[model samples]
Target chain A: MIRADETESTIVPRIEVGERLEAGFEWFEDTFDSAINWVGSTVAYISDGLAEILAIPDALILTVILAAIAWLVRNWKLALGTVGLMLFIITVDQWNEALETLALVAVAAAIALIIAIPLGVLAAKSQIASRIIRPVMDLMQTMPALVWLIPALAMFSLGMTAGIFATLIFALPPGVRFTELAIRQVDAEVVEAGHAFGSTPAQILFRVQLPLAAKTIMAGVNQVIMLALSMAVFAGFVGAGGLGTEVVRAISQLNLALGFDAGLSVVMLAIYLDRVTAGIGGGEGVLAKLLRRRKSAPVQTEETAEDKAATGSPTT
Target chain B: MTDTASNNVAPAVSVQNAYKAFGRRPQTIVKRLKEGATRDELKSQGMAAVIDASFDVAPGEIFVVMGLSGSGKSTLIRTLNGIQPPTDGTVKIFGQDITNVSPRQLRSIRREKIAMVFQHFALMPHRTVGQNAAYALEVRGISRSDREKKAEEALNMVGLAGYGGSFPHELSGGMRQRVGLARALAAETDLMLMDEAFSALDPLIRKEMQDQLLELQQQLGKTIVFITHDLNEAMRLGNRIAMMRDGRIVQIGTTEQILNDPANDYVAQFIQEVDRTRVLTAGEIMEPPVAVLGAGQGPRAAHRLMREHQTSALCVVDQTRHLQGVVYEDDVAAAVAAGAEGLTGLLRQMPATLPGTLLAELIGAASQHAAGLAVVDDHGRLHGVIPRVTLLNALADTSAEGAVRTILEEAPA
Candidate 1:
């Protein structure tokens, strides 16, 4: 009887595969440890910078971010909860590390959006490019995000670079997929109208498609930020430092309070960003107007090709 | 319509053998590449969206392209602005071949001399109404103040004066459409492409807008290529109508020529549901006036006058000769039989609401009541009676055109 290992041996022969897997894991673990430490340190610096710029106490930073978000979302209750979460993180005396984690997540998410949106647009407009890049995106989205650490460690050799690279891969898919989908899903009638006005392809894209897709692309950005937060915590396994590094340190030392505080801070930051961005996407509608638009805009269209390639959009 | 429009010279648009296609043919691109092919072969794969469509839009005339959905009116319209290029033939705007022109030239032509109003309006959701309207001028890189001024002027022209600051969602459908018109006008074009622009509006609003557009065209003297599926709208708006089917122009002619002397069964079917006289103006059939009666003429006097003229009715008038109700002989005879002597006649006594009354309503009202009904005024004074022959003739003419209209009216649109 043929075993699954026999089938795999044909693909990659001549090596003791189990040994190779162990060796790869060892390499990943070593790189992961140092990457987490570096990321943690960078996070600390960013947090300090944010506190100074905003003129808030380092401990109050998360609370302020969440409170601002809640205000924007018009959810005073949620805003108060964000304040409570911030105060809780401060009680654990990990406020500085928490601010660092927030900054890392913010920068990673921004970089992801900047790269992904343009790529997504390019994918939408070109059939050849879309066909080539779609399978790669599928693999990125489907493979366990831990796989990113393997490649990231090999290339970056452990530090903030490895942490950022890993966070970018995990958080990047939504931005590309959503931006592509939004642009492609622009109303055909509107596009034709643009054409009839003698708008060049670029003009139609930037003026008509992008503006229409703003909400969708923003949704992608929101997902990237959330995913980046999740990945940032996991980056604790690497040497790159952040609150993730503190959590790792606490786990190693068996300090439950520190680990729990770090974890909850991450959740608070995620909630704050998610709510704020979502409120923006929801638009400046009266409750009645929101209900009407929500009921109607979705009937507008569900997906574009960008979503189809990245699979971030369920409709695609 | 064509002759009058073109006699002045320099047609606004002319399409000669234009064709468009989508998708590939029998051989796929990969297969062709393996077999070693060229660009022209790859282009032939697409299905023809528009095929050999030829027509000229004369200056200051409303040229309507009428078709059922997917008849390539859309593709044809897009070609005028150089959005979609024809596989063969040339599209000339003011005798310049727009098909092979540079992208910059196309954009310039669109900015300066051509504007389009789409079916869905296409007003930007993110922008305010003024912003959407000013977008064309902005694309031409106009000054902010200059563009705003142009947009404001256009808004007032389209009757959307204060809607400038509002977003598209804030405006009603009619108001949004007005914004669309303003956007087109802001382009300051000599030709306007209206692709079913009014089809989405409510019926009353559609009529009002159509009338407003006609009034605008008359005043502005701009050429228009209007595409629609509604035959009634075509009849109402088109100076010269081009009926398309399956990406081909089936017939092209004036409304009267298409109706009265239908080129084919399709053209005949189109006007079959129309009230013939309504499609016609009073100017079409008016003859030189010959008084059938003198100043002292009574009902009896009008009767002899009509007989001599071989007409059943004669329009009554004062010494100033203002139009009054038409007097019918039978109405006079009936009033005489009723002992209401020295009175109005049949057509005079019967009520008339001008020649524009609906055929159905007139038929229903005059169905069996033939007492030579008094054609009264707001004061209920007799003017003239409606001769049965005149009503019958009008009905026959309308029902003939109305055959298509009845078929459409019963449709599931």
Candidate 2:
């Protein structure tokens, strides 16, 4: 067999992008030490504050408050279901870890929304900004959840703060994408009507576009919550304490019952959080319809574009 | 123009050489970098929607811009309130040049001076009818109580009372349009732009709405710029109608002038299918009666008046020119020959027509009566006469001269 020439069959060309990134990161760490320190401390302060508040509350008391909120925001059935899930976590002896995870997810998602929504609005306002952001978001969403922990650990130091920072990056794309979509989906005619009546640009955005897009933005918020929950367990490897750490401990000791109970508690908590958020998001739509019924209802059950056309618009 | 000036009031709206092009405006730097880019070269890059449209609308006048789709009529109307700014030229509303105003000033103008009623109503789906009507007032930062009171008053004005609590989705098509009208009324702007505002309703309802608008115009005296593709509607509502074609105003004149003297073949073709009866008022088609024989005039004078007016009959009127009856040429000649000084025997009974009577309603009376119909105003004063030939020509869709000659020959004239 003839040997291929050295230049001919090199399967892939070597690119020094990874090496450049590593060198850049090293340079950043050396030069931006004070900035990094400030950010890391801020993250620590917020995460610690949240964790302390969550941990101080008695499990039963916290559960009752959460259940009450669910009942008020949604309905009684969702409230009872939440109570059951909280009791299950307490019985499994994982209530403390569950609360810790809840604090981490809450802080992460809140930061993500605060940052993401405005960024999405900016992106939606400008095509060039949107073009630049879309690819970066795709990369963030597609990268393995664990891959983010490496940089996050280096930047913030390994702790719950680092875990939240990682979760924030992981969950941010959905919030941004949905917010941009919601703003763009507001009817152009409605916006024009607002302008025709002499509404300022800010007024149009706040009074018209924001209200019309509320349901869609809520859906985005729900997505962020779900993503944060999913990332919490993966964050445990970097010393982020939660049910994730408990599962990791069980795995190392090969204690089957402890791992099973811990995993079951995570599942219960995830299910409960998901249902409550979904109810809050979706229940308003049904409730609004029910309220409309008490007043004079539309001729059609659904006011579709076709139905509007059927009424014979003057534009015809 | 001088008549309006003498009254010390400017036209409600004045547009001068307004041109609008649709497409990305070429970058200024790009144009500078390129050598010798001609107007044609630049124009090729963008579609021109309006071309040098100029008109003046007097105060309290319903000026209509009439055209089919793609004729730039809608674009021209939108340019009035700075919704779509003209590429070149000026639009002044009550003598204030809106084109050069800052955004803040434009907003003030929109809020305080101009109101628009859309074809689709453009009512806010989430708001109650009253709230939708008050939207313009709310934007102007009026107090809520005042806005609500004004909105209710407007709804009542448009005959949409008791609909304040209902949403747009819950209302019928006609009611929704009424709400749209009420919204504009609530704005209380002196200038209103109605873009195909009544075209959406059923035919019967559309007629009713048109009548309502005319009634409102009498009460409010708003200077309205009405847009429509329907020539009949343009004829009915417009104090002066502007005909647009391919982004240019082909002609602007009164309904009678447009119907009798079309500017070109395009305008002629546009008005061809329009039902003349529906469009022509009796006042428009009526002519000076063959003769108005005063009650004091003898049969000889009646015969002389008939000959002078080139008619075979004469109308007998009182001293106030109020129409009493008509006398045929033969009867007048016979009365004169029989030496009868009193004209009672010469007077013939005939149907009387009103100045507001449509040419359609006068056609039958004109064709059946030998002496034709007398056109009178509400006070019974003789406005003019609608003879058989004149009524026939108005009703006919053929060439005007040919129709009159054919009718005159076909009749006993």
Candidate 3:
């Protein structure tokens, strides 16, 4: 069997005909090289420095953390499952590393949401704006995610910033596209209803359209979070850290156990977030149903309360 | 919202030659556009949904617009509230031309002075009942406290009290409709426009809502522009009814005038479906008694009364001048079987109609009440019989010339 060094040689492409032609491939080389340097620096900085996260919306932040615990482990059986999973991950002694991985994911998702929502609302409002923006959204959506990191590294230099930049691009399309589509799906009757109430376009957008489209928008958020998390792990190739780093690190050392544990942790986090998001999305569904029934709830409430609590996303 | 904008010369509400259209084909509108079609012209070629229509709505009156489906009733009503704009005309509310009002001004107008109720009840699915009801108030910047109070009051008014926290999906169709009405009522607007609002409800529920609307109207005296196709509903609710067809008003008049005296064939035919007897009251048709007959007289004796008075049937009365059974010729025959006194068996009589009863119901009740003849009334007492001939003659006098009594009364073959 080939040694680790020999494997690296096989994976890396060989030099071609001339320096100029080589330079023709220079973009890739430069991108990778910078990405390596960027990751190295970010690791160096994070190892020795603190990562500063801007203030989390207190309501959403606490709610999310509480939701993670409640949704996955609210019951004793679920609690045991979660505890077992956590012990398995920590026993591999990648807990600190997993925390770093989670941070990167959280950052990417937050950035994607920040960028996508405004763009979605803008697309919903103006045909001209949509015309200018839609083609770019198409490109972002169609292009493979890894391909973006090359440019991201070229532009931002290889580090947490570049890694996040790449992850953002990868996760962004779903949220923005879904948001625009969902907003468009808002009932024309609803729009008319808002108008009848004397709602201005701005008011209708904020009060009527967005809230009505909440579940759809939240679904978009789910896709974005999942995609960002997936992309963040892959980004470790450019020296972006987290469970992905451990995967690559273990692969480098030919340590299958470490690689397996890291991959397992990522899957766990993914499952947790997916459940929470899905739960919240389901919660909004309940909210909509409950809203419809509010008039008669006085008579029927005993029958519906349990359903509401189960489906209601206190976190959302 | 600029609802606070002053209008010194506003004419309440006015529509001038308004037209609304949609393209039958995409290219048609584009072709028109190329052919120098302006916004109005471009819009006109499309579906011409509402056509060159003009009407004025006075303040504090219930004005009903009646039409069959696709007759521009909904479109016209929607345009009044600024949800849809007219293609080639002006809509002025309280003197300001809203045809080109900025979205801000339009919102303000809708917020402060105009409210609309939709047939589907378009309540926001995401909001709780209180939240939905208070939506407009919030849009207009009302504080939470005041808005909640107003929403509560509105919900109570619509019979949705204590349901402020529930979501729409939890409500039934009727409850949802009430929530919608509550939402509009919460807006505190002066002008209320409804588009087939009660049509989606069941018959009994619809009747209840209609009664509620009347009560609300009576209490508030708000100016209302209501759209409906059911002639009965229009008659019941409208102070004035505008009959529309193919995008134009065919006729407009008071319920009494429209029912008793239709303006044209279209209006008359429209009236034909209505229970005309219900529309006209005894007070309106009452004139001096044309003839008199004794109590318990039969239609057989009505020949003398008809000949004496030269009238079809005598208005029968009892001893105390109260209405009693009509003394008609048929009653006379009946009395003969009962051993009538002398040559005239007039004591066995009956008249068509009772006091204070809807004459429209009389025909159907006639058989149940048993007697081809009818009884009239002075008050609650039995009047006299309108004999088969006299009744036919009276109807003949009132019916239009050559307008045969359409065997409108028939079970389908």
Clashes of each: 59, 0, 57
> Which parts of model 1 have CA positions greater than 4 angstroms off?
A1-58, A69-75, A200-202, A250-257, A285-316, B1-8, B25-46, B275-278, B284-394, B397-413
Which is better, 2 or 3, measured by TM-score? 2
- Standalone chain B TM-score for every prediction: 0.73, 0.86, 0.66
State the DockQ of every prediction: 0.18, 0.21, 0.29
Q: Which fraction of the native contacts appears in each prediction?
A: 0.34, 0.24, 0.52
Q: What is the TM-score of chain A in candidate 1?
A: 0.71
lDDT of 2 at A32: 92
Candidate order (TM-score): 2, 1, 3
The deviation in Å at residue B225 for candidate 2 is 2.0
lDDT agreement with native, every candidate: 0.71, 0.81, 0.70
lDDT of 2 by residue, B276-318 (tens): 8988888777787645789888988887787787878777889
lDDT of 3: 0.70
Q: Report the C-alpha lDDT of model 1 over A1-316, residue by residue, as the tens digit.
A: 6664465456764546767867887787676878655764564466446535544554466467758666655566767877877787677776766666776677678778888999999999998888877887887788788778876676556655567778888898888889889988988877776776667778888888997898898788888888998998877777556788988898999999878878887777677778767766766423324432321111111132112112211110
Where is model 2 chain B poorest over a 10-residue stretch in terms of lDDT? B26-35
The top-ranked prediction according to DockQ is 3
The order by descending lDDT is: 2, 1, 3
For residue A197, give model 3's deviation from the true position in Å: 1.7
Q: What C-alpha lDDT does candidate 2 achieve relative to the native structure?
A: 0.81
